[model samples]
Target chain A: MKFSVMVNEGPYNHQASDSAYHFTKAVLQAGHEVFRVFFYHDGVNNGTRLTTPPQDDRNVVARWSELAVEHKVDLVVCVAAAQRRGIADADEAKRNGKNADNIAEGFRISGLGQLIEAGIVSDRLVEFGD
Target chain B: MPTVKKMMYVNRRAPHGTGYALEGLEVVLIGTAFEQEVCMAFIGDGVYQIMQGQDTRAAGMKNFSPTYKALGDYDVTRLYVEQESLSERGLSVDDLMPLTYEDEDDDWAEKPSVQVIVRKELSQIMAAQDVLFNF
Candidate 1:
């Protein structure tokens, strides 16, 4: 089966990001196709590279970035939501005349259309958030 | 193009109070570009999004109520309102805007787009969805 995941809350604030990550890992282990993972609403915060969690805690955003790299999964963050929350890629930063980009590795800034498309094409779309 | 899945937007938050309602709608509106079965369910406090005569000027926010009126143009016509939710909030179907869509398959006939369903029925509809988006 194919699965698409949506994370709607930021890291640490809610268990949503953690739950989504574990669920995604399980899906991959089960030999399911991870079509796409979309970050929307407050979830876009997961795409920022500037977060530095303490050594005692798990780096939620870093974990997701590593997962994307290892599994070759497409991690998409909504551009509109990202812009509102100040999470941007290098190209987005350049386009918007910003000095820096904060988008984490293995995540791409895109429109909500990607989320919709993921829903349409994937066999299952699982949402984790408040 | 891939096979289309039946998608549902499970909206539970009230408008304006949070980013869920407005941002969720933005996704649904853009989703109209895909030829897939998409339906929106207004449950809990989400029913307020369709409430009629909304005046956000005092709140100093841009009123997005008019966008709901344009949903039909994008073929996003099905809006399931939980009947119990409405009553719980001391509201009725009369409190919501009368949204309609032109049925092109039926000679461009106009028909009501909002469908009021009981909790039991709504659950069944939810179970049938291939994809569910909630914010």
Candidate 2:
């Protein structure tokens, strides 16, 4: 089945993000297709390209990027949620006059409408939040 | 025959810790108003939402746990609990908000059509749903 996974929790500081990562891996291993992974609310933090976790610990940002690359999944971060939380891509940073760009590659800053679109096109939509 | 839209909502946060849970509840209410079938699953900290006692005025937030009781009125009846999360928090089935409880069964082959799972299990559970919304 085609799936659209929603990540609504931050990457670190909470188990939610880690859980999201492991779950994504499991889905892929089970031979299912991930149509997209949309980030919203605090989950937008997963898009930070500037994050630098300890080399020893699991680097979540890199993990997500790798997952997207391996599976060719569409990783979209909510534009409104990102800006509100200071997660900006290069274009968004320029538009907003922010000096820094934090959105990691393989993830694009988009809108909630993408989520709605996923609902319409995908067979299943799974959300991980709070 | 009319096909009832069964929407399974999974809530993962405490009642007042953030707005995701409440906003999610609102969506479910709206779904019901639109004649969609809605079921709820509380995993991880979301179990706190259905706890017997909640006081929000102290936080200057509107109290909405009462709205939970109204879910039954909306025809939202199924509420599932993750056995691991409940056991981890030392919570028993009795501590939840007067809902039926289901443990993680070993037989994944005969699992419920849909399930509410913890953070670790979310991806798999989400893949199974026709529509999954996480808050």
Candidate 3:
């Protein structure tokens, strides 16, 4: 079955990001297709490469990047939400005149239309949040 | 034509203390471009979102309550407000903004967009949806 995931909370502070990551990983291990993973609200924080967790802890942002690389999952961070939270990519940082960009690999900044389109195409759309 | 999916945006948060309500509304507005069958459900504290006469001046927040009125223009008409939630919060339908839409098929008559229903009824409606986005 094809699935789309939405992560609505930031990493570490909440288990939402962890839950979404595990769910996506399990879906892929079961040989199902992940149509897209749209990050919105605080969830956009997951796309920032600036995340630095304790060395013993699991790196949430890196996990998502690796998932995209290994499974080719479409990981999208909502542009509006990202901008509000200061999670910018190279292009976005330049356009906004920011000093630097922090968007991690395997993720793209986009509009909320991507989330709507994912809902239109995916068989199931699961959300993880507070 | 693309397959029309029944999409439901479920709101469970209040308007201002957090960003969920605003962001959720953003998604609903953007979703209209996809030409999908879209509807919104206001449950729990979410019913407060459409409450009439919301003033954010003192709070220093943008008053987005007016944007709900413009949903009709985007072809988003159905807004289900849970009746029980209203009573639980000591509010009634009258407390909500009068959101309306013009029906082109019916000589452009203006009609109410918010429908007050019981939780049981809302649950059935949710089960029928192809996608449910909760905030």
Candidate 4:
């Protein structure tokens, strides 16, 4: 089955993102396809290149990046949500003249329409939250 | 047959604390607008979103509990609350808004499909979906 997921929580502050990663891994191992992942609300924080957990703790952001790269999944972060939460890619930072860029690779900044499009295109949409 | 994405939205926080619930409803409405199948489950503090008579305006934010009633307009009728969450918080069905969903005008009450589910077995709901959203 083709899957599309929407993640709405931050990694360190909430387990929603971590659980989502585990669920995605299980689905992939079970021979299912993850079509897309749409990140909104605190989920957009996963795209911030600056999240660094304690070395002793789980590196969830890195894990998500690795999983996304290995699977070639479409990792979409909502632009509106990201902006509201102060997450910015190079283009956004440049446009706003911020000194640094925080959004990492393997994640695309998109609009709510992508979320709607995911609904139209995917066989299912699942939510992971607080 | 073409793949039809069955979407599930997980709500984790309660209403009035943050914008999570309202924002989540927005996504569901948008998802339903595209004619996709959408299901929602509330967990942890998220169960509070469905609680009746939420007032966030005192905090200087928009009062959005009204939006929950509008969900049916986009065909979002399924609203699931975790059994464990309710028990953990000592909440009762009566504490939540009437299971009845209202149309856009609020003139008629459309009873919502509400369920109380175990926490551990949540994966049963999760495993069946093609996509899941977390909020």
DockQ of each: 0.80, 0.16, 0.93, 0.34
Clashing pairs in 2: A49-A102, A125-B132, B5-B37
The candidate scoring highest on DockQ is 3
Give the alpha carbon lDDT tens digit for every residue of A1-130 in model 1: 9899999999999999999999999999999999999999999999988999999999999999999999999999999999989999989999999999999999999888898878777778888997
* 1 versus 3: better lDDT goes to: 3
Off by over 4 Å in 2: B1-16, B21-132
Off by over 4 Å in 4: A29-31, A54-58, A94-99, A123-127, B1-13, B37-54, B69-135
Q: Indicate which candidate wins on lDDT.
A: 3
For residues B32-92, write the lDDT of model 2, one tens digit per residue.
6555455677888887888777778888988988787776556665666676778889987
- Which candidate ranks first by TM-score, i.e. highest? 3
Estimate, for each residue in B1-135, the C-alpha lDDT of model 1 and write its tens digit.
Answer: 348778888889889888788888898888888878989999999999999999999999878888998888889889999999999999998999999889899997988889999999999999998778885
lDDT of model 3, residue A123: 89
Per-residue CA lDDT of model 3 for A1-119, tens digit only, reads 88999999999999999999999999999999999999999999999998899999999999999999998999999999999999998899999999999999999999999999888
Q: What's the fnat for candidate 3, on a 0 to 1 scale?
A: 0.90
Clashes of 4: 29
Q: How well is candidate 3 docked (DockQ)?
A: 0.93
Query: How much is the lDDT of residue B128 in candidate 4?
Result: 82
Ranking by lDDT: 3, 1, 4, 2
